[model samples]
Target chain A: MARRSSLASRIFPFVFGLVVGAGVLYFFLPGPPQGGKVQTAQQPGAKPQPGQQGPAQPAGSTLAEVRARGYIQCGVSTGLPGFSNPDDKGNWTGIDVDFCRAVAAAVFGDASKVKYRPLNAKDRFTALQSGEVDLLSRNTTWTMSRDTSLGFDFAGVIYYDGQGFLVKKASGITSAAQLNGATICTQTGTTTELNLADYFRGQNMSYKVLPFEKNEEALSAYDNGRCDAYTTDASGLHAQRLILKTPDDHIVLPEVISKEPLGPLVRQGDPQWEDIVRWTLFALIDAEELGVTSANVDQQMTSASPEVRRLLGTEGKFGEPLGLSNGWAADALRAVGNYGEMFERNVGTKTPLGIPRGLNALWRNGGVMYAPPIR
Target chain B: MRWSWTDPRMRALVWQVAALAATLVTLWYFAAMAHQNLARQHIATGFGFLDNTAGFGVVQTLIPYSEESSYGRAFLVGLCNTLLVAALGTVFAVMLGFVVGVARLSTNWLIARLATVYVETLRNIPLLLQLFFWYFAILQPLPGPRDSLTLLPGIFLSNRGIVMPAVETTPSTAAFVLCLLTAIAAAIFIGRWAKARKLRTGESFPTLIVNAVIIIGLPGLVWLIASAAFALAPPVMGKFNFEGGWRVLPEFLALLLGLTLYTAAFIAEIVRAGIQSVGRGQTEAAHALGLSSGQTLRLVTVPQALRVIVPPLTSQILNLIKNSSLAVAIGYPDLVSVFAGTVLNQTGQAIEVIAITMAVYLIISLAISFAMNLYNARVAIVGR
Candidate 1:
């Protein structure tokens, strides 16, 4: 009886300590996102329908979370020249990078308060959906499936692009129709692969595809004579050509296979965050249409035009409802300049890419880049 | 029926049941949390995406596949490619490992030292770097199709791949195949019968030469009977690449070469240790009985060494199969690169896709372990 009492006394503290430790650890462990609410069914469309407002009070507000964590995390491409390539000093420079800065400028009033997460084609969507990035400003195509099924919202089109083929000049393949029984190299997990297949099937031609995980590998395969041609977005072709061994030896065929309305996106549950990203993009476009340049934004603030006054936040309280200061558009414009300025600075004719603003030009200038008026 | 705290048996049972309950609760919590999070995120989660069109092309496929094929078919194609590389790598590694392991124990100092050097040099380097070295440094610099090096009349080596003549089958090809199968079966039967006769009569037959003759001679005789049973279709140079022939891709060759060489080095070490584990007295006993050196090894050392060799050898093979997932780095289109990668990205079904991929690898590894364990039992020390 004494030995039994001693054994019980020995194990009682150990058992009690284990229960106490487990209770403490359970509280310390990070829980899931709070407040489970049913998600409103959204229509799967690239273009946002007019008069469709985001939820007034989100279950878990992304804006409040962003405010708690100071800087917005932006997901960009690993490296695409005029889109989101990092320079030698590791400072990212591209139109996509500038758009990220514009969003940061609007929210925090500081352009440099944003961090970049460079992602590949396969991991871009996963990274955004998992809340690793606040916005995906990468050159992602705005498609129906991505908008609805993937649980994302496309803010607006940043670049009106299309797929094209890049082939060596020595091969003398002048047109895409001539690429029969040819082996083409492209990046996997991208729309380019599907477009190539559809184009070939429609033309009643045959070809083989060598899909690599990254664009650099695909380009390397094409350069090593493993593939007859390379295919990607036409803007991407122009940008990637400059990094080739002999840029002058290749030519992009004059055929646009599919429409690629590249844009920035955010996750769908947080409607307020989506509205903020959408309005920031619209502000840049509206600023360009209203002749509000970054250098002259302060001077144009006092102009007589009500549209410019409203956009510059001089005549309205449009920014407050989206959870920002009244002068949010002014701050965004001051950081990245207008849309035209961004286009010309990164991939315009002056740059090595030398891409002309063809379909990306304003609607009044023989292009279809119109934005909804900020009423 | 009150529980007694001091009763040893009852206490042990209670603790075991409590631990099991804790583990079950933890696992259930994680699963429930994952499902809840997925639902709240509004991300589509299901295996229905397998029926959707893959809409992508793979460079090399063992089965018939096109862009119009479903994602499930693409997964099958990737799986076949992976299995092909793993099987070929295993066969070549085992053969080369045995040779090198035996050579390391050679009487000549030069051969032994050379074998040691080969093992040390290969096993020390990372497998991925070796893959890159074989792929980019060695193969990529080869001449293009226009300037291909003609190895023979119809074989060409280029950066694209190795282009060789393909055998075009004729009407008598099936007869030729049947003859080959019959010879193989006859050889096996003859081998067993010779073993029985040797035990019964105390005299050995020339089983090796006779079995060899049956296997090779029968195939040769059938070919001679049907002279035009097959024709060679040589590759013709086209505008961009060679057309209409068998082309072995450089990516596949690089992966196979890297896997075989790296694994063979480890396998060599295992084999050397296994052989040395056999007592030296056993060899001396066979020698005292006037048995030849070759016969001593075949009759005594190998059977004993196999018991020690198989368990570790199974590990190295499983490592090789898992290492094939690195095919994505060089565009080899293995299962991970195609299904887990491209399919996951397109469908945005991360939970389902990753779970499926992990389950497949688990099944493959378990199957290998089960088979190897059975073989290990067969070679195990059986005592009364």
Candidate 2:
């Protein structure tokens, strides 16, 4: 009887202690966000697919709220060079980074009033939809499903890209068609994986895909001969190829597998916020077409041309309807150079990536990047 | 209320029911909130996505899977891969743990200290870093398939993967296996009967030799009878890769190595504690009975130590299973990698995918505890 009681006593206290410890730990954990942070949801479509539960309180338009908040929280790529990578001083620089600066300039009239949220590919849309960021200027592709189903508005195509492969020169693999039975390395949870699958299947070849959660891991794995080819957007291949140990040894394949129209996206519900982001992108392109560089944006305000005057926001009230001052376009242009200038500075022919404008050049330049008039 | 408080049983029942109701209410509230939030966002909240095509390829699938397969099949493939790694990892860990645990207690200074250093170094470093080290630093840098390190005549190692021979099962091979299993069962039966007979009579049978003959000789006879039916198919070098036999891909090897080495560190310490908990008097008692060291350890120590070992060992096994989710970092395509990482992203069914994945882990952890508890109870001491 004594032994049984002793065993019971021992078991009871340990179990009780564990429960108590768990309770204490739970209380010690940081509580959920308070102070008007609303619960957010993400779906893909015009209508709620299964159910719809609106917020308890109307938080009002995302525009007024961002203005009230000091800075625009811009979500960007975790670290894609020439897109949204950070420098040695932890300052984010890239085409995507410059686009965020343009958005900040349009809203707050100061590009410096922008904070960056480095997000993974999978979480980028969610971050935008949840109001964790004012806008997602990541190197995200615009698709019909993302526009209608996910309830997001793609501002514009910032860069036109296509899926391709990088292989070692010594491997003598010049084209993706020769990559039959090849093992491909790429980042998981992205459209890149699906594109690779479609590309290989369409070519009537069998291949294996080894996916990593991070781009760096995938790159290193590919470098180590763990895979025969690495696949991503052509621009990403160009940018990331520089990091290879023997950068000159690897060559990106010739075939472009899938259309990747990379752009910035905002949530669908707020028209004002959507207009602000869209026109800001347009103003950058318009400024580029008008030969208005950031260095001469303030000087160009005195130009007599109606198009330049309207694009600089001096001849029209386009900024008024978008809920910003008249100099919103001018501010955006002055903060980040025109689209072409920003492209050249970060990832174009002048940069180490040495990428030709290709499909990203404007309409007059024989590329498809055309923007609507500011007026 | 005051009158009921005088009765301890009544008070206990009231508190218990209240607590149960509170837990149920909390659970219902959260579930409802999730449903409402998903609805508010226009996010489709259902398991319908599981019926859609997976459309992506997994690196290694034990079951039949293709791009045309449904997401449900993909989920199963991921589950099976997870179970395979966890089972193999646990088995390898226990074996390694026992050796290291015993070595820690050895009288040899160098061996004991080395075991100590191994345990301390591994247990302190994060498993993720260790996994990266094994993958990037060790496995990834191996030579290409054409220049594979020949481990043996039939085994090859390379950056592509490890190639080894696999058995080519034929019609007579099944018979050989069944014959071998039957021989083991007969050997156990003879051992039991001989033990009973020896207890009854002073005379003894040579049960050891007889059991060995039944176990080895019977299987040997089956093999001899069907000699031509079985053939060894060793891995052969091809132009670009191995032509035949099984290939242990580098990702799988790296994940398994990381999991086994990391979990074994904790298991070894648990074993060391369990063994130490056995009273010194028990060992001394076995020595006084003139039993050999091995017999003493087998009869007196291990069984007693198991009482202390099983509980913690169960936790470590569960930990190993959970830690296998980090396989995504190295692209092993385990449950989290395939289902949660890939499928969740593809379908954008965050809530449902997360819930289903959580339920799977819960079921697996519960199953482990259930099996371990049954074994634990059997070995538990009974009061005289």
Candidate 3:
């Protein structure tokens, strides 16, 4: 009986081990059989909406879900000078930084209520899709592929840019046509690299590309004369040109190769949120067009014009339809002025970027910054 | 104390089973979550995209490839480049390792110190940093083609690459290669016969001298006869760059040099340990048997030391294979760089691209292990 009992004990543990191993194997071996079924439950069904056919999200959904989380999760670049870079005190400041603050102001009514997450170009999309950031205000280009295929909604163009090339003055090269057979330094995983190829190929010019993982590396390479020229967004070139030890030693070529409509982005499947963000930008543009600066916003709030009164929360409930308070636009404007004010303060004539308001001007001035009428 | 139901083995088995079960449950939950999430996102989970044409062009390729070629072909190109780098790196590393390893045990103090310094300095730093130093700091600083550094004869080294005079094979060269193969086969047969005669009659034959003469001399004779019979075209240098000659890009050279030098440091340590593992008694016994130092090493030391060296050596080889992934940092389109980075961005299928890349690496690693196992089994000591 004792021998039999001992044998039973031995077999019991062995059996237990086998069972446990099987259990572990089961878990490790690609999950449950109904795995695919679980996924469909989370994805929303297709639906069309007016004003924007963007991805869908719940109406009046949790804003506290963003704020009680401490800071408004804002994605910015790793380091783009003048646009999104840390100051000596490690505080981020730039045109993109202000956009993040503006979004925070619209939500929490406090511009400083933000957590800045720096992301590289390659990781920016995944970061957004994975919901690591609530909004992406990096200097990202808006393209059809990114919008439709990648499942991301662009929140209106914040910066109208075009591709340009910068060469050392010593090279004496006046046109991009003369740059045939020359090596050009450019950042990889960007629209600029593709634009460079397209432009050169169209001109039937053969040039070697020296690609760098970071924009700073490419810029430094160009500065050190490692390549004959550097190419990127004209605004980026302007910003980078300011940091040059010998700024006058280099000059931007006259040719503008490709149009780059830069903007903030949000993940797809959130139309309610997309509309709110999109119109927030439109409101700013409209405010600027209607001559509503932050300094004069209080006076304009009581203006006789129905549109000005409607925008400043004095006359209409426009924000209620978008699941925001009537004062959201007024708060955002107070925090960061109108579009024209933000532009000049951040990257316009007053700033080192000195980007002229060419295509970025209001529609009445023959530019494309047109916002829908505030009904 | 007397053993009971709570015996050590029983306890161990029980604990192991519990741990395994818990791990399995966790894995299942995570897997289910991923599946549900990916499905919800409408991302395709299969390998159908491999059939799609790659829209980008590769700067350098060994095979016929175009922008319209399928992703599978791009994958193949990446794999080929990876293997090419690994193979070339292994050859150079072995040669360098032996020299450095021997020099470490040298009588000349300066030479020994130099080898020591080289090994210590290289082995301590990370391979990626070394690669960057060589590529960016060393190679990128080279003058442009207008002021390219000219080497002896028609060779030049610049930031672009190394341009060397190359030979173009004519029709007669094919005949020469055939003759060379035939000569090598004849030499092998002669060597076997010579070894057999030496063993049977207790007579020595200089097989090495004979084989060299047959293999090299016969091939040279055939080449001369072919050239006399038929006119051949030789490669000539052209303007700007060598027209018909092969040019090695600076990126490739930098990667190759970095991988080889860094890997050689580890290989030297392996070789040193391998040589030292054989006991002094074994060498004394070899000497007692009237064998020369060279013979003693070949017959006694290497066989035993190989048993200890090979397992660790196999791991180092696998490491070199994986470390080749760093080629992305330098713009060499190895598997990870081309497929995972470029292809993933182009296709916007991160999950699929990463999964494929991981699977390819796992397969390569497994194949290496399997081959090494076969070799290990062949050389393993047999039971009494």
Candidate 4:
């Protein structure tokens, strides 16, 4: 026993001493210059020198990179009907995917010059920031913290949304306040979860939250009576409600707890790339305002009107500064129709979602959506 | 080089030193690379996120938790939930395993066949599928809270959870707990005393009776004394669901049920192998000493079987603990689901979160092995 204990005693100190010594070495040894400055706030366009032997990835050069690679890497949602969903043949469509295709057309003059990567809410920010995707066209909610802190810049609002609750009509939960002590289900790792807590806590009510990694799982749980209510974007509730057994049996609550301006995003450092995407979104909306339908875009290209000619790339060199051909906007408009066309094709009153264009209509049509003109 | 290689001890030492150096350099390089990448991407790396408000709620929590609580508290809640599942799973698995293991060796043809079928069926099916079956198939199809299946007067099962009556708080709860601890201490002392007396006199003392009286009778007495303040709280139905009772959420039930059923199969095999390992002559020797079949199996077979049984049992326990992390699939708020999934996503601190999570499992596995080793040493024949 004495000998065994002595051996244990010796072994323990040696192992512990090695650990202590290694820990000390780790702390004292100087690392790279950029590693220590862990800034709480992000500064866009800030570039630390690249490694000695590593390949150069200059900040804000996404356009050149995409051109060099011969395809744009666009991050989209895993599946959200009318926003980003793959059809039976694995062909991706919806407003978000349309924008990705539009960006591809602008860059390569071919709508198919893009590879789609499906991202969940948690992975979208990292995927964009890590240069895994050239642009993020997922239905990501644009927020101040995500824009500044996470090094992402919102290009433009593709869909305006707000947090709302979906409950069975049989339960008669009219307002958000009536959901006190009710269990809510939502997709985990999103701003929607935080909004759920804030809304409940702000009202001095307690609610059990059941979070699922996948939105479909959460919706399934809500359907199976695992939760009393499902909370997410108002638009999402409308879309998800269609999949329920009796869509008419559930009601979207009146309260809009938080604003969720759903938009495409890009890494913050790339001003040129950000402009290209921002303009692509605006081009769609502007095309709608200019009455440039996909059917009439070819004919309009021959029109004598200067603004119409400029927009269709018949008069000016507008796309040159954005590092593209003048026909880029025309290609984008042709690829996915205009913004109105994109909206009408997927999520408008005609679609299964049957959602009326409430806040998503153009400003000229008495709605908040207004985009800058292509000069 | 040949001369140095001829000395095995020296060669081993040199190789070990070289491997250690290589490991250290690789780790250092990776750390440097990670630091550079994080910096280049402008992602902060630190444990500061632990202090940030979790800003979310969980379906079930043992300890007091709120959206206002820090991420650290959420981590603690997740850890507690994990331990709760693992500890309960271990106990149930071992109990069911011992029964099944013994049944596999039963002389009755039907009983042995049934046990064999059970072991074979569960051992072959994947655990994740079983967890899904329990969660999505079985529990989900149950009635809603309003139409819960009432098993008894105060016991109900719904999709939300199994609700049952429980003892409400007592004003003298601490005092009662204290008396219970003292009773356990007294029982241990009495057992030792009896053991010593039997060694000296060769007349066995009834330690079991003394232990039962001390352990149960004392606790029962305390409960009786405190019965005035203690109350049973039955679940009260409300507008939408039940109001007050001890609630076990379906996620917890599914995870626990799945883990126990899956792990018990392997543990049963281990137990069977252990029992068979004990020599037939040992049982014969016990019978020759006028011991009954039951007594021979108990006094001679089990004690010896335990020596062989414990090591493999420890591995099974560790597997159960690790498998409990699959709770994420069924939305059980275990450590992986809450801390690693939600917390990691929210804070975007993958390195720190994953490292801590890996360390937690490592430490838990090591500790279980340590405890089992101690028990194994005690059960091993002395001076062999």
Q: State which candidate has the highest lDDT.
A: 1
Per model, the share of native interface contacts recovered reads: 0.44, 0.37, 0.11, 0.31
lDDT of 4 by residue, B195-241 (tens): 89888998888889888988888768877866644678998887667
Q: What is the TM-score of each candidate against the true structure?
A: 0.90, 0.90, 0.85, 0.89
lDDT of 2 by residue, A121-149 (tens): 77776677677997899888887767655
User: What is candidate 4's lDDT per residue for A108-189, written digit by digit as tens?
Assistant: 9999998999998767777887789999998888887676556577898999889999999989889888998888888877
lDDT of 3 at B308: 72
lDDT of 1 by residue, B207-291 (tens): 9999899998987887888775688999898867889899999889999999999999999999999999999999999999999
> After TM-score superposition, what is the CA distance of residue B141 in candidate 3 from its true location, in Å?
1.3
Two-way lDDT contest, 1 vs 3, winner? 1
In lDDT terms, how accurate is model 4?
0.84
> How large is the C-alpha RMSD of every model relative to the true structure?
7.0, 5.1, 6.4, 4.2
Runs of candidate 2 with Cα error greater than 4 angstroms are A1-60, B1-6, B200-227, B236-240
Residue A207 of candidate 4: its Cα lDDT? 82
For each candidate in the order shown, give its overall lDDT on alpha carbons: 0.86, 0.84, 0.76, 0.84
I-RMSD for candidate 1: 10.0
